[model samples]
Target: MTLATVESGFNGEPAVFTAELKPHRSLGPIGFRVLMGLSVAVTLINVVFFLATNALPVAMFFGLDLALLYGAFWLNYRAARAREIVRLSRNQLDIHKVTPAGFVRKSQYNPFWARFDVARHAEFGITDMAVVERARRTTLGKFLGPEERDSFAKAFTAALADIKRRV
Candidate 1:
């Protein structure tokens, strides 16, 4: 699920912005299972036809192809576990990144001092985005599409500007 929250801070302070970003997968769990099942069934049927024609090696190669395809889908599902959470408050901006292997990393920056950097390409639109504080830079939303990244950049920049104005 994609979650974006903008809340007022305690004691009537500036609004806080929090966004949770995840990779968008076109196929859901049920769709993925159905796709894999159909592929395997088709491959097995082809393999059986080859085996009946005395082409046993071709059947074995078909099995290997199925194995590779399953492996690729498994890896894609595993990597989908990765996510990024960004929180911008009046005092600080925090980013939490979780890897597919369950590793977690965090970065913090002063909202008053941080700069939002967006790298754009002529054809592709936004290519990258990050928050820069002093000499340190933390990249964010690596999994988001170009349009999503652009929308996020605008919202995040507005939140930062609001905090600066309040301060």
Candidate 2:
């Protein structure tokens, strides 16, 4: 199962909830940090090349490189907010990349029939990721941290079991 946090509103106060995803994997915090780190390293290489060749073009090249990097990061940010993936099999819906926890769905959930559901997820602290539960699908939680995914899984499975018993 996957784990996530959910919250609403932006005035620094809002309702919060926790969520559980079926089971899935996604690039975590480490991945993003690595990607950014690599880009910076490549920029350094470009600087070295420019210095060695005495090619004034290096400045322009660097500028272009920086621009591309900026765009990439900006889009990644957007994607993180876009709520990339969500899939539901049963009454329960598995939220994908439910931010603040980096949740990925694996199995399935019956939305209506299922008695229990994860209506909330991890807290929105540094990552601002919080999973919200909806009968249908809702766009929320896009960014994620490293350890949250694991936590969501445990919570989600338990919720499912509880729901089944209630039903």
Candidate 3:
């Protein structure tokens, strides 16, 4: 059940750490479509009943509600496209974040100089993980659940430690 993969780097170098992090979405495209269809069907049926009772205003409100629901799901699906990729080689550590709007942000650090830190709460378990180098700190695994974050932190920490021992 490993979520991260390590591969050989360019020029025959080996990868030290690599992870692809994405937000969990409970509904897939088909499930979302089905849910939306069912909701719209029910809303339309209720609106038809209201119209028969001369509640035209209520029917209009139902339409508005459906529109809003559609917009919300659209935005959610868009955001689900966001992802974070982290890769560490013997020389460098790179973090790339891609947002829903297709904006990309990249950060690089020296593997020997960087430190992996995990912030945790007693009851809630792990909260966040970050890579710190000199004056800069970039958080990782913001989209991961507590348990996932904990697992990532352990594996990442071990990788960093191995690098440190070799250097």
Candidate 4:
């Protein structure tokens, strides 16, 4: 029943973890490159459209918005990359995330004997989790990386297994 984080990667004593991304949790580097490229292309498209319409101010506004979003995405991606969360317990798996706007927390509880499950939200996207289950549940990440959802899911599932084995 312990949670331990060492840097971006964490190990739980209740179970004990050797931190690394699991098979299901791994995302190819190419995906991120594509995402970055798409984001820039999208922003450029908006800029071009606005310029063609002769709406300088509107174009600038959109540019700023896109820039901010890009920054957010880049930051999140980096954060995710730098940190690995290893779960080695089944009592409580609490994951806390911080951002400029605020901090978000995602956790899972594993009863002595319970199955783990991940629930998908259509609105949240299939790769991203709306809810993660152990014994009961808690809302997962609010702003988890959409492009990195598959990787997250695999990692989360492994964490759940680690918890189950410990308890």
Candidate 5:
């Protein structure tokens, strides 16, 4: 996932930490189009060969394979739209998650009571991260890769500490 850290605030106060997280899309539209074009070319060539050999069923299977591949790419593109936004101000910590289907879930906590929780692994680095406040636990950055998670956790932890110190 893409993790972008930003510093912003309202009025004349000091800037607060904000992070916008999004799922990584390795292939852009151009790349996808190129890949699909190549696939179609290859499938057409196979279809021609199968038809010449009188293997009609085999040609149909090739069409099915192409359809399935296109469907897989479509699903991936849809999922890449999901995102998370985190804002840490002096008084509050907020997490906003938006799914691919446009559903939104938000969690807010008092900065004084919220805790930044992280689970790490020796080989994989940071495996999980969450915000814990009393009985509530809100997970963050599930779509982020290990390195992204590490960077986010460090920045978020520092922001939390700074806010707490100001209290």
Candidate 6:
């Protein structure tokens, strides 16, 4: 549940691996603020120009456009809060998925029985990954990009192998 637990190992066993995955966003909070400020300034300048040219409707629409742009960025930031956490130890593998709205879903598996599976594409690299245990399968790293997914798949597979060897 916490980074401390993962770092210290699960239930006193050695920690194999722990990964907290989040979606990549190019723009940070300050960047977003700066971008919005510039957008507002540009919109205001255009609006004033339209008003001076006797285009009242165009000026109103420019304000509306700025509002819509702000709303879009707000939604993007909200969605960026989503994350996936995976932890593996000698005996257990735990995965937690957290949504932007703060809902958390947890899945557990015995390290010996669970397999880290990846579906690969010749052109696109890793297309999907999952934790499979007999008949049950839980998808993972859906928010990660292709390169991140590939890196995660390699590390997770190695950790799983290490855990299995110890058992």
Model 4 — which ten-residue stretch has the worst lDDT? 16-25
Q: Candidate 1 has what TM-score?
A: 0.88
Residue-level lDDT of model 2, residues 25-117, one tens digit each, is 365678867977887788778878887888768756886887797687666565554243433332345444444344543323354453332
User: What residue pairs clash in candidate 4, if any at all?
Assistant: 8-83, 8-84, 9-84, 15-88, 16-88
Considering summed lDDT, which 10 consecutive residues are worst modelled in model 3?
1-10
User: For residues 1-167, could you state the per-residue lDDT of candidate 6 as single tens digits?
Assistant: 44334333336666679899999999998999899999999998999999999999999999999999999989988999888888887778988777887667778899899988899999989989999999989999887899999999989999899888885
lDDT: which is higher, 1 or 3?
1
Clashes of 3: 0
Q: Model 4, residue 3: what's the lDDT?
A: 21
TM-score, one value per model: 0.88, 0.38, 0.89, 0.37, 0.89, 0.89
Q: What is the lDDT of candidate 5?
A: 0.85
Best by lDDT: 6
User: RMSD (Cα, Å) of candidate 2?
Assistant: 11.7
Question: RMSD in angstroms, candidate 6?
Answer: 2.7
Clashing pairs in 3: none
Candidate 3 local distance difference test against the native: 0.82
lDDT of each: 0.83, 0.48, 0.82, 0.52, 0.85, 0.86
Supply candidate 5's per-residue lDDT for 37: 99
> For candidate 1, what is the lDDT?
0.83
Output the TM-score of candidate 3. 0.89
Tens digits of lDDT, candidate 1, 39-63: 8999989999999999999999999
